[model samples]
Each structure stands twice: as structure tokens, then as C-alpha cells.
Target: MKNSKKLFRIMTMCLMIVMMMSVTVFAEGEATEYVPKLYSTAWALVPPVVAITLALITKEVYSSLFVGIAVGGIFYGGGNFERTITHVLNDGLIGVLSDPYNVGILIFLVILGAMVSLMNRAGGSAAFGRWAGQHIKTRVGAQITTIILGCLIFIDDYFNCLTVGSVMRPITDKHNVSRAKLAYLIDSTAAPICIIAPISSWAAAVTGFVPGEDGLSVFVQAIPFNFYALFTILMMLGLVLLKVDYGPMKLHEDNAKKGDIFTTGARPYAYNEDDGKKENTKGHVLDLLIPIFSLIVFCVIGMIYTGGFFSGESIVTAFSNADASVGLALGSFFALVVTILLYVLRKALTFKECMDCIPEGFKSMVPAIMILTFAWALKAMTDSLGAAPFVEGIMKGNAEALMNFLPAVIFLVGCFLAFATGTSWGTFGILIPIVVGVFSNDHQMMIIAISACMAGAVCGDHCSPISDTTIMASAGSQSDHVNHVSTQIPYAATVAVISCITYIIAGFTKSAAISLGFGLIAVLGTLAFIRSREKANGTYIE
Candidate 1:
């Protein structure tokens, strides 16, 4: 079965190459602006299609994405093969290594690793395990708790995803609640909440990318149009109440029932590692709390520092000059130093054990880093080749003619870009620039367009199995990424179908109150039904 899957991936990759080549020859004239205009829209669409087709058929995200990236690079950089290769090295690989944006992400991941390790090594994980083992007695309670945590952490998607997974995994595992379920809970909460929240990194990112006359006004105007984001949060609430596990997620539930489990953290959990000096039990709740609180506080301080609270510069100027990577690194280091001292003072583990734990924790993040690098590479190559411009031209130029169906069309387009690139941020970045450009000029259309961009990017990420949220969900759950993708796809599709309808109605009405009113009611009503059905079937009962 594995061999066949591998073969299928190879064949699909070959097909993508052929399609790209054909497009290069046929539409060579149009791409003169960028890379000789090798592939027309018709041709450009082939890579994502092929990538998705292969991922669905072969169930290999990494291979599928790499193939898509290669196709894009080859198509865009074909004339300058050596230069293209160099570009991938300099721009794709080293760019990720050197750029402030990419480096900041890496530092954040490392800090997250350190924090998780500190918690686990200090016996904070075990304490939670013991506490949850005693308190979270029922399946329904477990799922609900997972959802609640997801909702509570609305400050940022990265914070939400990593912290929720790290803290909850042990508790979820203790209750025999599948990791896949935990992953879904985390994944659903992260982007969905970030989109809806007035203050979040996602919102800030949008603000940064959008060229605007009034930052506050533009943001306020955009609230109504962010349909998918609002709808997805509704869907998450619905899923929590209903316990509807369909698609790949359903399989994960079944696997959990059969006791299929994988752990992807510290070596101490593996049971095979015999280096056991009896694990630390002195690590109290405060050991975890201190580091976590410190991390958060330091991050805020870092933000302030960057924003010029200390520097005497204007906040905007300071922020513009700040490097997120440096902030994350410094914050993490501070947290790590403080947390290590706590452990030493508490005797949670010896100094050596603490030291060993840090390296292991960082090592655990390797897969995530690799996935991010390749994902970014694919995004850079496509963006350089005018992918966003092409999509924007098509969508904006046709918005007036296709007024009623604009929501569904935009939603689908956002989904396509997210799925292809596996990064909602990237998809959001591309769409916002274009959508803001189109909508900022007109009041009526701006609300709808901006909202569509938000909804579309989020919807795409929610569905795309290749997306980082999906990957983190799978990784955190210890489920196969493909399995998680397959399971979550159906549920995502259902919500999207409903969301599209919501978008269409909202567009024509152009009344935030009306759109939100009817939309929330419809989503809640659907969730109630699903919950009732699940309870009746004994799938979930409170």
C-alpha cells in the first residue's frame, strides 16, 4: 500500500511537470512581465490541481508540495536554471534562514520547544496528567475542555496552536481522548479565533499589508465581511457541541478506540529510552506557570521595546524597525533562564537533566521547521511569478458582473491559494494587498471584498490538509498528517458550503447586523442538531 502511494505521488509529479512544460510552450508570450510569461492562468492552475490531486490520492503532503514548488520554480525560473537554482538556495533556503520574518518564526518555535520541555521535565506535565486523570472523567468533558482552551487563547494563532497542544496533549491522552481530536480542537481554534478577534497578530498582519487611509476605519469596515472566519468559529462551537467526527477525523477516532497512539515529544515519554533516573515529581504547577507567564510577559515587553516604549521613538516607527525574530529569541532565552533557575531551586530535575531536555525539545521541532521551510519556498516562488496578481485581476475585474455569487467565488479562490501554498498567512498576504486595493476605493464593495479576503484565506487554510494548522494538529495528535487531512476535509467542506451561502446573503444585504444575525443563528441551529444526533447515537454524551 505504501509503495503504491509512493508510485502515485511520482506519477502525479511527472504529470505536473508535463503540464507546466506544455503551458510554457503555449502561453510563453503572456508571461513576459515575469519569467517570460511561460504559463497562462490555465496553465498556472495545473500545479495546484496536480498537487491537490496527488495529495488526495497518494496522501503525501510533503511530496505533493515539493512537486508543486518544483513545478512553480521550474516554470518561473526555467530560462535561468542556474540562477533559479541559486534563487532557491539564496531566496528559498537561506532567505528563510536569514530574513527577520523567517528567523522570528524559527525563534518562536524554539522558545515554544523550550517552554514545553521545561513544563514536561519539571513534572508540570505529570501534575496536569494526574489532575486531568482525576477531574476530566468523561469523554464529553474532555472534548469540551479542549474546545474551551482553544477559544481562550485568542491573542495569536501561533501561541494558541503550540500552547494548547503542549498543555492539553498529556491531559487528552490520559483520558483516552485521541490526539487527533485534540489536534482538531487546536487547529480549529487558532486561525478561527485570530480572524474574529479585534486584537491579534493576524489582524495586525492584515493591517500591515493593507495600504490604508484610516487604519481603525478600514479595520472596522472589514469586520462584517470576514465571513469564513466568523463562520468557522461558529462551526467550531457547533462541532464541540455536536461531536460530529466525519472524514479523516472519524478514522482517527476509530484508531484511538483501537489504542493507536504516537508520541512526538521528549524521549522520556517513549518508554524505550532507559536513561531513566526516576522522573522529577517535585515540579509543581508554579514551575510551569512561572515560565509560561514569564514568556508571555516578556513577549509583551519585547513588543513594547520594539514599539519604542524604551527607545523614545514613535511606536509605529519602533514596530516598523523591530525584528520579531530577535524579540522571540531574547524572550525565549529570558524565559528559559528564569525557568531553569526555578527548576534548580525546586530540585525538579538536576542541572544536567534540564540541559539535556532543552536539546531534545528543540530536536522535536525539526519536522515543523522542515515543513515550514518548504511551504515558504513554494509561497515565494508562486508570489514572484505573479500568482496573486493573476487571481486578483480575475476576481476584482469580475466582481461587479458576478455580484451575487461573489462570496462563493472568492471563498473558493482563497481556499485554492491556501491549499496550494499550505499557508493561510501567505494566502492572506496575497489576497489582502489586492482586496484592499480594490475595496479601499469603494465603500460598499470594500466591506464585502475585505471580508471575503479574510474568509477566503481562512477557509482555504481550514480545508487544506497541507496547511500548517493541519500539520500542527496532526503532529500534536501524533496522527498521520494525511489521516488527519482526510478526516477533517469533510467537516471543513460542510462548514464551507454553509459559509459560502452566508457570504452570498451578506454581500447583497451589506448590513453587518443582518448578516451576523442570520449567520450566527443558522450556524448555532445546525450545531444543535448535530449535537443532539451524536448524543442519541452514543458518540458523545455529557
Candidate 2:
């Protein structure tokens, strides 16, 4: 097949590159703390670039990610076969899996998956869907509700993605909304909203990256200048209210109207098909409401508790210092316990049935976990190759020459770095400090640049196929991963381009109101233009 030939050729090229590098490594004896010759260079980015390109081209994730990891191992090991194997297995995969924070997130995902399964098995999802069908009459209402819920769960993006997806999937399905659209809604809102929300884990991460100044204060001041996050919100609302869907999203939306929610003909979560058949008829709306309410309450408590709220810290201070990984894991665990008890006590499901859902829940999250693990390992490879320093060096080297245009520059660099690394947080850690150091004397510009860094990072993360948030969104919505990525790129890129322009304006004008106002107008205008085009083409949904 043509596809097979292409893949074979790509693999051959990769092997050739590795062999060539092996010859080079043999010439230089390895040291204990062996650093790759390509470390802290532009070549450090090649691994992720390969992975992302291959994923987009092949529409396959696992193999593409493995190839990326292999490339990174080759680079890091300097193509020494044994070294590459050990680095890939020992220092890459095992390293990430052994991380406590990552373990916590995995545990949280499993528990949440279990809880969703329990909800479905108990017919909580069905009851809620039936109730929602009576009230939410239109597709627009369903989407708007999904957005509102996503925004409300701003404490953490991970929690936001899964929680909102679990709660709204049924409602959105009832209104014939495509899973891809639902994934987009969830992905767009998760990081974009959290990056702007002062109390969120994202804000905390952003603040921690700034060492010299008042981090929280700067974060608050930068909120208005975060054009991508702000404009993404506007774009979502505009797209929903105006009923505008373009690019691959339009195709998915069109197909969804014909009763096919997944246009790609791939059911990644096909195991969920039997959920309706097994639903407990006695399940009521409260079955869903009670578990979700408990989750939100406990998650907040768990987050603040980690931040020392119980040890006399203020709510704001606690939020600013919370460990989201530990918090979400702890919170989800207790919530799971409560949900199981509630189900058993109400006789909605027997104890054996509740126990059965645990592994099923874990099974549901396997795809997400695998993708996340590969992503983290790939990130580890990049880290070992010093991708952060490479980007940091470039930003620092160009900081002075482009002072006036630095915000725009920073935005683009942030976008590229985040897109390559598939991590907005890592991008923030790399670029924010550079912006702070460059504009230390110019407080106003400093704020704008920092905001631009965040906006760009989110934009890139939104677009990157390897991004964990994007992966989580796909998992949360039960949409095919590749379908979600392919459908959402046009939408995210549209906002990203507008945000870049807004950052440029902010860099010169130094006025949040003016820049944001221009951005809002630009977003609406672009959406309107797109809507008109779709309508003219006879592709617009009524």
C-alpha cells in the first residue's frame, strides 16, 4: 500500500540517521554524565517534531509516539544501541512512571474512570440525560452548558476535562452534538480558562515560575493581556451562538446531524456501548447529582488541604500553593469511596457490581494513560536533550534587539515550544522567567509579555496532538484522538493568529483595553466571515 511504503521509507530514514549518529558516538568515548552532542541545540526538537508530524500524517498515535521516543533515545544515547535501549526504557519510560506526581495523576484518572463507569452502570448517566433532554432543547443550549460547566470547573484543567466530559457527554449526545465538537469545547475551555483564572492550578504554576517579583500580582495584571485565552473564550461563544462550524469541524458537525456523532467511524470507547443495556432502572437524577457535587466539594477541600489551608493559610494563599497532582488524586479517591457507598446503600447496584466497575473504569482510561505515558517519556527525552535551555537561549539572545516586538516574538516562541514539547507548563517554566528578566525595569511591558507567554503556550498546547490536555479532552469526550486533533486545529489556529496580532498591539500600545477590544472584534469578525462562507457553500447548519 502507499501508506505502508511511506511508513517504511520513514522508518528507513530514521534507522539511517541512528546508524550515522552511532558512528559519530563511537569516535568520542562516553562519560558517566554523557551529554549528547546535539544537546541544547535546535536538533533537540527533532524528536517531538517527528512524532507530531507522523501522528498527523498517519492518524495513529501509539506507534508515532514510540518512534518519537526512539528518536529521542537515539539522540540522547548518541545512537549507541545499548545506551539507547537503556535510556528509552530505564531513563525514559520508567523515569516518568516512577514520578510521584505522574503516579498521582494516573491514580486520579483511574478513580475518575471508575466513578464514571459506576455512574453509567447505575443508570445515573441515563437518568440525567433523560432529565436534560426535557430541559435543554437545542444543540446550542447543550454546547453553551458544556462551556459554562468547563469554565466553572477552573480549579484544574485535568479535573475540568474529565469532570465536564463525564457530566456533559450524555447531554451533548442527546442534542446530536459531535464528539469532536465536545472534545473541542472541553479542550479549549480547560487550559484557556485555567490560564486566566487566578485561583487555578495554572495560575499557581505561572506564578511559581517568576522568582523576583510578586508572582500572583503579576499574574493578575497579565490576565487582560492574555489574548489567546480570552479570545478562545470569545471564539467558543461566537462559534456556538452564531452556529458557525468550519474546517474539519464542519464535516463532523454535518455528520453528527445525520445521527453519527463520530464522523471518523472509529469508536475508541466502544466498550461503553453496553452501558445503556446494563443501566439500573431505579436510578434517579440524584444518583448523578450527588456524586458530581461530592467530587467538586472534595476536590476543593483536597487542593486547599495540600496547600495548608488546614494549617491556617488563607484560601487565596492555599490555592496559590496547592499541589494539583496530589490534590486531585486524594480528592478523587475519597469521592470514589463515597460514590460506591451511595450506590450500595441506595440499592442502585450490588456491592459486587460496584466492585466490577473498578477494573472497567481502569480499562476505559487505558488509552489515555498509554498516550500520557508516551508523552511524558517523550518530554523526558527532550529534557535530556536540553530543549528548554535551547529555547531559553534563543529567547535571551534576541530579547534586547526586539524589545518593542518582544511580546509578539515571545508569543510565537512560546507557541512553537509548547507545540513541540506538548506542555504549556513546561513552556511557561522556560519563557516566563526570560520575559521577566528582559522587562524587569518595564513593569507594564513585563506584564504583557508574560501574558503573551501564557497565551502562546496555551495556544500551542491546544493545537499539539501530543499535549496531555488535548489527549485528556479526547478521552473525556470519548472522541477518537486523531479526529479531535484534526478537527480542532483550524479553530485553535484562528484564535492563535488573532492573539499574536493582539500581542503585537499590546507590545506597542501597552493598553489591555485597546488590545483586548481589538481582539474581541477580530474574533467576532472572523467567525462572521467564516459563517457566511459556510452558508454560501451550502454547508452551514441551521
Candidate 3:
């Protein structure tokens, strides 16, 4: 640990010196409107690569992400100290924070955090856990119920992550399911489910990206060919039923069975040790249920309202044009108000106690909020460096030659881009248009390729540590962020591999049924094989 810290410090100092020297050399000239020398080149991807690699290697996220941002600043400013500092702060951090959408998300997170705190303090969470324990008698039952809830809340991935995590965390804890596993379940169902759900924000984002076509019709047609999203769900069920886990996740699970839900010492958002002792006796299941249900209903209504539902747009059109950040912020605010009123009316807590939760809730979410800000700043750096164009050039340059193999190729590209930038919607924006243009005449192939793009984006988002959904999952489950990322990767990777192969099959066969059928069998077959190996090793859970 000391060695790693020293190395990190040394690396940071060296980068600073390089920037200072560059400043001395370039200080003589008057600054002009600056464009990065590395814009739209392969080098644009270096910052995220640096950040992600360091994060995985160091098991420390904040410093790693800062280094990545600094690298981006260096690249953007050509090593000039003043330019690098200004760009990193002005364009990277402040720029992203200044955006209304990002602010809305931050607000939503804080409000949701407050709501979760309220639920905990009022004893709604404990009451629900007690209620669920009566009906869900096993670890398996607890996990399956979590999955079912995750799948049901598919309006938006962000909403799904926090809502599922807040609701299911208590139940999972009661049954000895690891926080890492709960996070994985919450994350796996989030984007994967949202990408395939037609009424979701993801579906809206994808549809808006396509031009000169009926976007919704195209999205609906592409659904069956979305191998990654479809197969992720299948894989989750197979793992749950087969009672098998492998790689880092298995260790976490084994530890959980032994009463250590967190295999590592790091527990970033753990509740207070005395929290259970403080539970109010007046709290009931209704306290939790009513708040969650209202959140869902209001969020849906809030989303459509932003899309102009009140102004006469149809529900489908409203959803397809909704602003998730704004809608979620609005909905969550109302939900928080309603929750406060409910608590006060029921005498679950005094109004002052409810008021105190506001700050407590914000404190709980601080870690997640900080990570998101850095992630967004990193993305901003990538954007300024023109990562999108770099990717666009690659897709356009290679599209025709890879014809029948294009969907598979597109999937891989989507994965790499989204993984690097940690933004699935951005990946969709860059790759979908290229696919549309390339396969425009062949409507069937266009649909398949688009599905591949969406699938790959979600797959990458699922695995990337810097991804907001992934970060949210960690926060929701109160697991160490790095631990969540490390454990979830193997499971996501397995599904990704199968999805890649399925996309290849879809390209040649042009039949969703055939390709999807093959993918399902492959998933089950692989899980069965894994179960056999675990049994042979005497490590099978069941």
C-alpha cells in the first residue's frame, strides 16, 4: 500500500513538472483560440484508458480519475501549465457542472438519498425487510425478488439503480446476499432492461439518434436482435437458478454466506452500527411501499410532462422525447415532499427528525456524487479531444469491407468506445448514424446493426467502472465502488462474449429467432458447465 501511494505521488509530480516546463517554453506567445493538437485522433482515448487502468491497478478511484483528467488536460493543452490547469478546471470540471442536465442528476441523487435515509430512520426499510423475510425464506428467494424488482423499474436506468438498491438492500442483507451481488443484480437489470424497453429513456435516446426514418419502428424491430441486453437477463436467471458464481463474484458470495457480505475491508457507504437499534416501532411496510410507488408514478408522469404530454403529445411521443435528468429531479423532489408529509402525519418521526434526514441523505450520496462529477469531467475531456469523431472515422472507414460481419464489428467498437468514455448514449450517437448510413438500403441489416450498437453500448456501460449507472449501483448497494466493478466484470464479460457471437450469427442468418435461440442455449450451457466445475471443486453453493 505504501509503495502504490508513493508511485501515484511520483507519477503526479512528474506530470506537473512536464506541464511547468511546457509553460516556460510556450509562455512567450499570446494565447489564441486554442484547438487541441490531438483532436479527433486515436490519442483522444488515452485519458480514459489511463484513468481506468490506474483505477483497476490501484484500487483507488479518486486519485486515478484525477490523473486521467490531468492526462487529458495535458493532451488538450499540449503540456502548457496554464492551459492545462484552465482546461481541466474551466472546461472539464466547471463546464460539466454548469450543464443543467448534470445539475438535475445531482439534485435527483441527493433527493433520492434523503428519501432512502428517511425510509431507514422511520423504520420503513426495517419493516419491509421484516415483511419480506416472512415471504422470502432463502438467499435465493431474496436475490430473485431483487432481480424481479429491478426488471420492473425500467423507466430509466438511474431511477432503477437507486430505487432497486434502496428497496432491496435491506432484504438482501437479511438473507446474507452480498452487497456486491446486489449491486450486480441492480446494474445488470438497469441498462440492459432499459435499452430493450420501448418506453424507456434509453429507447428514446436511440430513436432520436436516427434520422430520415421512423425511429420508434426501427427501435421496436431492433429489439429482438439486441443480444447483449436479452442475454444478460437470461444469464442472470441461469446463475440465480443454477446456484453458481465464478471469478471475483464467487469469493464475495462465499464470504457473504459466512456473514461477511463485503469480502474486502472497504465499506464506503455502510450504515451506522447502531442503525438497527434506532428503528422506530411505528414504521410499517406501507411507509416504504407508498413512497416507492409514488416515486415510480410521479417519475413517469414527470418524464412525460417534460416531453409535452400536457401540451398534447401522445404518451409514446412524450416518452420518446422526455428529458430524464429533469424529469427524475422533478419526480424525486415531489416524492421527497410526499414522504416527509407521510412520516409527520403517521407520527413515524417528528418533523425535525425528517428535516435532519435531508442533510444525512446528502452526506450518504456524497461519494457517488463526487465520483459522478469526475466521471463527467473525464467525459468532457474526451469530448473536447473529439473521441466521437475518432470513433466515427473508424466506423465509416471499415463499414463496407466488413459487410456481413459488420454487426459484430459494430458491437465491438461500441463496447470499446462506451467503455473508454463511460457513456452509452454518447456511443449510440457516434455509431448508430454510421450504421444507419452504411446499411441504409438494407433495412433488415440496418436493424440488426443498430441493435448491435445499442447492445454493445449497454454492455460497455455495464462493465465500465466510471459509468454513472455502475457508480450508482455501488452507491445503492452501499458496496465499495471498486469491489462492485471488479466482481461484476466477469459476469458481464461472459454475457458480452455470447452476445458478440450471437451478433455474428444474426448478421449471416438475418433471423432474430435463430440467433436469440442460439444465444439462450449457449448461456444455459455455459452456466451448466460452470455449475459442474464448481461441484467438482466442492465449491458449489447448493
Which candidate wins on TM-score?
A: 3
TM-score of 2: 0.97
Q: Write the per-residue lDDT of candidate 2 for residues 136-163, one digit (tens) a residue.
A: 9999999999999999999999999999
**TM-score to native of every candidate shown:** 0.85, 0.97, 0.98
Q: Give the TM-score of candidate 3.
A: 0.98
Model 2 misplaced stretches (Cα beyond 4 Å): 8-32
**Model 3 segments more than 4 A misplaced:** 1-6, 25-32, 271-274
Evaluate candidate 2 by giving its C-alpha RMSD to the native, one decimal: 1.9
Task: Write the residue-wise lDDT of candidate 1 on 376-467 in tens digits.
Answer: 77666666666666776776677667765665677778887787656776776766666666555567766676677677787778777656
Choose 2 or 3, whichever is better by TM-score: 3
lDDT by candidate, in order shown: 0.67, 0.91, 0.91
Q: Tell me the deviation in Å of residue 53 in model 1.
A: 3.4
Model 3 per-residue lDDT at 65: 93
Error of 3 at 154 (Å): 0.6
